[model samples]
Target: MLKFAKYFFIVFLITAILPLVLMFAWNNSQMEKFHNAMAKSAMSTGLMRLEYSVKTNLKVQEGDILRKLYYILPNDKNLSHIKNILNDYNTEVIQKPIKTPVSFYERKNFDLYCVTLVPFDNSTKGLKISKPVSLDLLRPTGPYTIELRFNKDDAAYEFKNVAFDPMAFGPPKKIFLLLSRVAKPHYKENSRREIALKGEDNSNAAYLTIELAFGPFRGMIDSIFTSLIILLVGILSSFVIGLIIKRVFVTPVMALSKAADQVKKGNLNFKLDASSKIEIIKNLYENFNDMILNLQTKEKLRESFISNLTHDLRTPLVSQSQSLEFISQKFKEIGLTNEYELAESLAKNNEHLLKMVNLILDSYSFDPEKLKLSIEKADLYEIIEDCKEQLKPLLAEKNIEFVNNIYKGGTLIEADLFQIKRVFINLLSNAIDNTSGENKYIKAAARFEDEEVLITIEDNGNGIAKEDLKFIFDRYYSGKSLERKLGSGFGLSVCQKLIDMHNGQITVESEINKYTKFIITLPLSQHPGKGTKEQP
Candidate 1:
């Protein structure tokens, strides 16, 4: 479980951390775009307000200049005084070297008359023009004698442009100021657009001008602040998500895994809590608990069945054995030869049957903790010969060869004589049941090796399949082929248990259609250790 959790946590971290980092980066990018868009929107609104402010100030300035020009025009005073004042105002206030020029014109028959009070060259202030400038060059359109038109040639004129005469014609009609730019050469290309006045008619018109200035855009959000916000959100989200997964997925799965291990180790009472909110996890826990409960139920039924079965069979088998021996002795005393032999065979068969019943009882009631051993030096060959004698009828019926290959004096093993004899009987009986055909043989062999007695019971017969080999000795594990007529599936399990109690090991080697061999290794002396007790 420790190893599994370690590796699973690594996988979880990879799955969780990588996506969180990617989401953080993507969210940061989106937030930056939104911040820039809001900043631009705010700047656009500010630009509109700035344009309005410039228009209002330009209107007031225009009113003052118009008043000065009007006084000079009607009073017929020398325009030089007002023109000089304009030049001074332009140089000091407007920050330009020349004054705003004004042209005067009056309608005449089919043509127009125009004169400039201040020349474009600015050579002399209020220089009276010798000739009229062309009125058509201004392209005056609509009811306002001075019309505002955008100049494409002057790219810096982001606002509208109005070309008009700055000097007063007469004081009579409606007038308004317009913010606009003048065409190039007269001012720098980057200069702010000029503001000029519009009049309803030529009878009483006065025009004045000023420059409009606007500020640049300034973004509001800080880069570091945006990054901090993203980081905080990412961390909070990761924490919440990680907590949820641990509660919903990881914790429940680990619980189930631990529970499964306990069940495997014969702890049928172990269970897991089944009350999870997640549907799949809840179902999983519920199923695991249900399975453990079923196993516990089955185990109880099995133990009860074994107890009842052994008690029912053992009593009758013991009585029948005693009765059969008495009958055999009576038949011998009456001098009925054939009947006496039949009775003797019946007695032997009855004894074998009684032994089988006892074997079943012992196998069912086996417990490692309650094991008792009568360890003594006994002949292993004598035990094998006895087991063969018990199974001699079955061997003769099948015309099989029974080969005892033990050394002359017989190998001795420090073990319980009865348990060792039972092991040989179970093994030799299994070999006899499986072996057939004319040349079939069951071989019993033993040797002393490495301070242990190695006993082998082999058969030339249909060998065990590879799939069944691993589970061959497990209780109630019946292989596909070795179905004994006597026991259910406890023979090998019993043999293995008996060998384990003697501080010994039993193993099997086999190949399909070749040969099956059972190898039993027992220490020359029963060592007082695990699975062994002092023969008190």
Candidate 2:
């Protein structure tokens, strides 16, 4: 059953949790993809809008510069060489008119450079400007905008761009390095799509190029709350499902198991109510009830047979005892010791038979419901002596002496005389039987303690085996050396039962091949009445 429950839990977890786990995994992967897609989409859309905004700044404007540079271009041989190259420049120095007619040289690439000379203007007289004009003021643009220039010279690219910041979600923002990695600049046509990265080139024009940096999006579905919600739902659902299974299946099976244990212990008088809606459980209960009914019926039949047999046998045993007593009387009148000894043997046999019949009835009917003890006040000393006399034939046969060491004056004890006498007879008889081959002596003695009478019966005979001593008084139990004189195999059990009836105890101490002692403790003033009574 334990193994079954473990398997049930394992299977339940697997079935219940598997789909949730897969769903969570899929959801997580999709969320990551979505975050990336949103980042690119947002970047592309924002960059397009931003470029239009930069274009609409309304700050930079183109103007004619030919008249200002006409003398320098037509006369100077160095500037006349690349007239088209010189024409492309929107030169602020010529328009703003700075001191010394500042000559600017741009490295086209390698040792080749585009050097242009702007001599004094043809129309304007030679004059140096009073104040220095800021180059940034001449060419205006926004903070995010960057402009780069390229030439066919030693230096391929002229650095004119500013660095971008890292990505940040809120105030106290940090630089966004999301699209800040520097890669070899390549031109691609403007197209809106999800990309691995985000950045823009306003035009493919050479010499001067404008770049706009955009970033990836951070989206909502990639949050910790989504995964947390999924995890919590999965765990809670698994536990709830487990509990439902336990209540519906495991609990009922365990209860059914408990019922089986009671039946195993031979208790047939129990009511098992497996009144469940489950079909199998209902059928199991039905079969259990039937088994109990069958057992009860068979037990009744067996008890009835034994009860009738014991009752009928007792009558004939009484007649035989009478006949034997009559023969013994005749032999005694003849003063024949030899014949009297034989008579004693016959009498012993008869007594043994009677004891057997009574033991059989006691063994069968000894439950609390059927047990009745005929209580009375009797002398302990007389009971013990009578028990010894009852076994004299067997004692003589084995040449075993019976010593009655009980107090000379009788001690009045409250007990069931019949039951108590049987206990003494059985113990002494057992001692005599065991001592037969060894030619040993049997001693019976008694004394009074503060509140109990302790009677000790011991024999110098092959004692009970050590392993057998513990269960020697259990019903139907026999020691290996027991003589089976009572033939019913319940003599010691009956002895124990009778002593218990008087609110007393019986114990045995023994050593193999040495001696065995039976100690019976009876209350000195056990109030004389049946402690309990019932009908079989």
The prediction achieving the highest TM-score against the true structure is 1
Worst 10 residues of 1 by lDDT: 175-184
**Once model 1 is optimally superposed onto the true structure by TM-score, how far is the C-alpha of residue 308 displaced, in angstroms?**
2.6
Clashes of each: 1, 16
Q: Which runs in model 1 stand beyond 4 Å of their true positions?
A: 1-298, 317-357, 408-412, 447-453, 481-487
Model 1 whole-model lDDT (C-alpha atoms): 0.61
- Local distance difference test scores for all models: 0.61, 0.60
lDDT of 2: 0.60
> Where does model 2 exceed 4 Å of error?
1-293, 314-351, 361-379, 408-412, 437-439, 446-450, 479-487, 527-536
User: What TM-score, to 2 decimals, does candidate 1 have?
Assistant: 0.45
User: Which lDDT tens digits does candidate 2 get at residues 1-536?
Assistant: 77888888888877888777777666666665565565455446545554443333211211123344445544543433334444454222234332233222233232212222333444232221112112222222322223333331222433332434454232211322221122111112231221111111222222323333232222332233455577778889899978987987798787777777766544669757758788887888788888888888997898899989999998999899999898998999999879988987898789878877887886777674456665566777788778777777678878998888877666888776777887787788777767766457988888889999898999988787777877777655665655323234577777787788778899999887788899999898766455543222
lDDT of 1 by residue, 120-237 (tens): 2243333333132232333222111222222323222222223333321222222111111110011112222333222223342222122221111111123324444665677687
Provide the TM-score for each candidate, comma-separated.
0.45, 0.42
